[model samples]
Target: MPEREILALRQRNAELESRLAQRESDDNLYRFLFDTMDEGFCVIEFFDGPHGPLSDYVHLVANAAYARHAGIANVVGQKLREMVPDEADNWVARYGAVLRTGKPLQFEQELVATGRVLSVTTFRIEPAERRQVAVLFKDVTERRRAEDALQQLNDQLEQRVAEALAERGLFAELVENSVARVQVVDTELRLLAVNHRAVKDFEFLFGHRLKAGDSLPERLANFPAERARSEAMWRRALAGESYIETIEYGRGARLRHFELRFNPLRESSGRITGACLFIYDVTRQVDEQQRRLQAEEALRQAQKMEAVGQLTGGIAHDFNNLLGGMLGAQELLRQRLEQGRLAEIPALLDTAGHSARRAAALVHRLLAFSRRQTLLPQATAVGQLVKDMVVLIHRSVGPAISVQVQCDAQLWPSFIDPPQLESALLNLCINARDALPAGGMIDIKCDNRWLDDSTALALDLPCGPYLCLSVQDNGRGMTQEVQEKAIDPFFTTKPLGQGTGLGLSMAYGFVRQSGGQLQITSSPGAGTRVDLYLPRHGETPIARRPPSEAPAQVQRAAARILLVEDQAALRMVIGDVLEELGHSVERAEHGPAALELLESGYVPQLLISDIGLPAGLDGRQVAERCRARFADLPVLFITGYDQSAAQGDGRLPPRTQVLLKPFELPDLVDRVITLLG
Candidate 1:
């Protein structure tokens, strides 16, 4: 053995020892790095299987993180098929492709053993020929869940956006097609959008087309009168105010009206952005209102004129008939006196006086129908009044018609004019007679009634107790139209000259003036009924005096009487009558002369005066003056007019009596004798 060879061997041994120590140190550092990494690390070795090359793999190396993520311990030498049988083939195929192609592959998969999602990057181990793969992976279960949730949220958001766009499209369509003119403007008063109606209206008004971005004020410039108002409205809307107004345009048949509204448009931030204007045509509304008012006024005028004409004509016809009777009777009396027919004088005079009395009654009826007659209201028993008028009603209806009276046992009293009520009842009986040419039953019923709220509303009357006097007739019933106008003056259904038409009108007026209601019900085939609802009187009704057996013989008395009359013929006739009754008479043609005579100490036991004597002082004033001198003087008032003036304040002096004009001479004599007694 040589010494040099020994030395070379020792050196080689030292060098080999150094190289081995460096390799061991590098392997330890790599192992430490692999174990400390956050990502899971593993190395897989592939081999040929029954299917193909690189068909399966075995876990050759695994870091501590890989063990922790895979939820398996000691997995370094385990086959991928053994750990995750279901996914082993898939994983093997993926890693085999990377190993064979020398390409890196990234994918996400689930670990069945731990049920954790993993993001993996696979690459071939160092050498190209090596059928081995190194896997760098992370447990990304939480991140995957978050990404899935985000995707679902995005899908929902897309659906909501699509729905919102569809709704917006529908709203736009509705606005565009609306009948009302609609316009949208920017803050600068420039038009942004307009409905079809607005475009058409603008074109009609300005004779030009309108487009977006056109200034609203400029568009209205052609209508100078409306430009300022339109601008002001836009300004107000821009200031966040809303306004509405109505305006009229054009004239006559071409007239038009518009109701305009200006509304402020706002942004999501609640800031005023622009304005929206709406215009509605109101021409028909305005025209209809005007026409209705005009029609109502015209109807009122027509009703008023009809009432007046009817009243005038009725009064004239009635007066002429009455005057003719009186004039004819007087002419016959005059002829008898000229022929020296003394025996017929009394009968002729009675006939003339009767005609005059009839004329006075006609005047009274006229006044009653006009509602101008002074009525003496009293507590009148309705049942008694109806009973008393039964005979008169039967006479008026004639023998063909039967009259029946039905009254309550304890009938209520009515506050009304007794004479007027009797006249009204008589008129109703006559009307019923006229209705039935062939004849039918007439029924008069009187009863007490309590009107409730509903009843009062139906009758247009106050709620209270009332005395109901109903006159029903089973005769030729009136039609609806006739019933409606039955109470109108001179609205009779009778033939020409057969009916005066004032019967129902007079009764209606009398009943109404006494604070009552008159209701008539009838149909074409049904019977007619007239109901008079009179207000109940608080006081008890006074008992009426029975009829006298015969006229009492007048007792003769001598007394001086002052007679005041306006007409000379009447004064002389009355004076002669008073003298024939054994009373001295002092005559005066007028009120002043009568007063002068009385003032000159011509005192009398009674003062007889015409109520309507002409002059500065009326007959009533003269009588008052005479009474001052003679306190106990009796007064007898004779008048063709109403005695309301003489009965001032609804009362006359004590021992005062009123005798209507054209009274019988015997009745006059009897009154004078009774007053002088």
Candidate 2:
């Protein structure tokens, strides 16, 4: 061999040796990678079966990890169906497709034989003709359980979120429809949210609609008078203060009241972010309270008036009796002087006369307070009476007060004592004039009123048609306290010496005695109104007798008279007066004594008896007993406190006359002669 040949041969051998060494190293690295992999790796070979092509696969090679995952050792060269008899056919189908199409696939499955969950990936090995597939898998049973638990938790969380959203919707609906005016405002005083009521109320006050983001100041700018207060309240609330207040808004009939609350809205960190306003209308409630207060005051006034009436009536009755005796004695003494029998004591007689006249005036006042004054009641047109008194009322009230008399065209006639009624009108006018020292208008109105049960009950009067006489004045009105006692005797609002304190009391007594009702309505700074309700006289007005007419003089007659008197002094004076008038008089101390005489057949032509006689049998009873025997007997009643004797619709015997106490001897003689004749 040549030297060249030798060298070439050596190089070829070295190259061969190098190539062999590299192949060995590559094989060792591949074995190490395959054995040390975390995933289980296996190679499968497909074979035809009776059911279909590629129906089964045999494990040709498997890593150590594959043995652990499959739970089978020495699994190489074993068919998958044999190792896992209950395995689903879908496993074979999925591997078969990877082999046939030479595509990679990944899936998760449970191994029944090992009771393990596995994530599997398969791919066909190169060489289209070879029916072989490589599979990589990982045991993932614990990981799958963790994933399932997480999914359940996510589903529960979604359900809770949906419920929370539903609850929020319901709360929003309630706020929107609430009757109370609700609003939310930001720190900048801009409206964030408002309920239906808030919107409506805002529009009613400002005549415009409100929306979110509108400035609160702008909303209240129309009411400049209230804007400052509203702004201050809002600012306080935003500063974390809460407050509630009642605000009066509007004026006159459109006036309204609202209770408003401001509450600070805060964040979780306790910092105030805004304020919430809640408003509620309280107009109706306030009005109702005021009306109830007025009703209570009116009831108190009525009770006071009733108490005064009772007290005065009792006092007047006792005083009348005393006056009767004193007047009677004086009249008897005066008769003696007139006959020229007491000429030597003429100065004493004159002194007695002056005292008697003064005593009569006091008696008149007592009767007026007691509502038992002798009254000559006649039906008179009220409109005409008011027309007649217009001039006098104006003169009494003074020129400062503008007095106006308004009479309805169809004014009803009233049954009242003309003189007493005139006095009451004059008193009312003077009081009204004093009230308006600075000058104002006064209205005197006369009209007809038909009171129903409810109105009558309110006024403490009987239900009927009445003549309503109202005197209204624009003046410094009375307070609630003064109005309550206005009708009580001796209750006066005037200063000392300015008023007698009996003006209203006398008016009240006179009206009550005439079967009428009296009401006074007044309020501070609102002037006063006095209403006089007189009973309607549904008959034609009686023609007034001319004042020039004198009493008819009767011829002296000797008549048998049964005189019943309770007081000894009064009885003696009356008996002497009857005897002086040329009448045969029989006297009794009381009704029983008088009855004894009448029952014993002591018949008298006339019976003059005191109605308030002592004992069980009164003057009326004695007269009744006398009349039983002498049916034609003429009775003349003498009384100081027995006003009932004067009442009745022609029920008494013919020639019956009631002579009030304190009568003159001439008057008594005239009555006796007229009845006897």
TM-score of each: 0.38, 0.34
RMSD to true structure for each model, in Å: 32.5, 38.6
Candidate 1, residue 579: lDDT: 74
lDDT of 2 by residue, 553-613 (tens): 5556578888889899988988887776677889999888887786787878888988877
| Per-model CA lDDT versus the true structure | 0.73, 0.73
- Which stretches in model 1 have alpha-carbon errors above 4 Å? 1-322, 334-346, 371-374, 378-416, 419-528, 533-553, 670-674
**Quick one: best TM-score, which candidate?**
1
- Indicate the residue-level lDDT of 466 in model 2: 94
Question: Which residue pairs in candidate 2 have backbone atoms (N, alpha carbon, C) closer than 3 angstroms, thus clashing?
Answer: none
Estimate candidate 2's RMSD in Å.
38.6
Give the distance in Å from residue 412's predicted Cα in candidate 2 to where it truly belongs.
17
Q: How accurate is candidate 1 locally (lDDT)?
A: 0.73
Q: What local lDDT does model 2 show for residue 553? A: 53
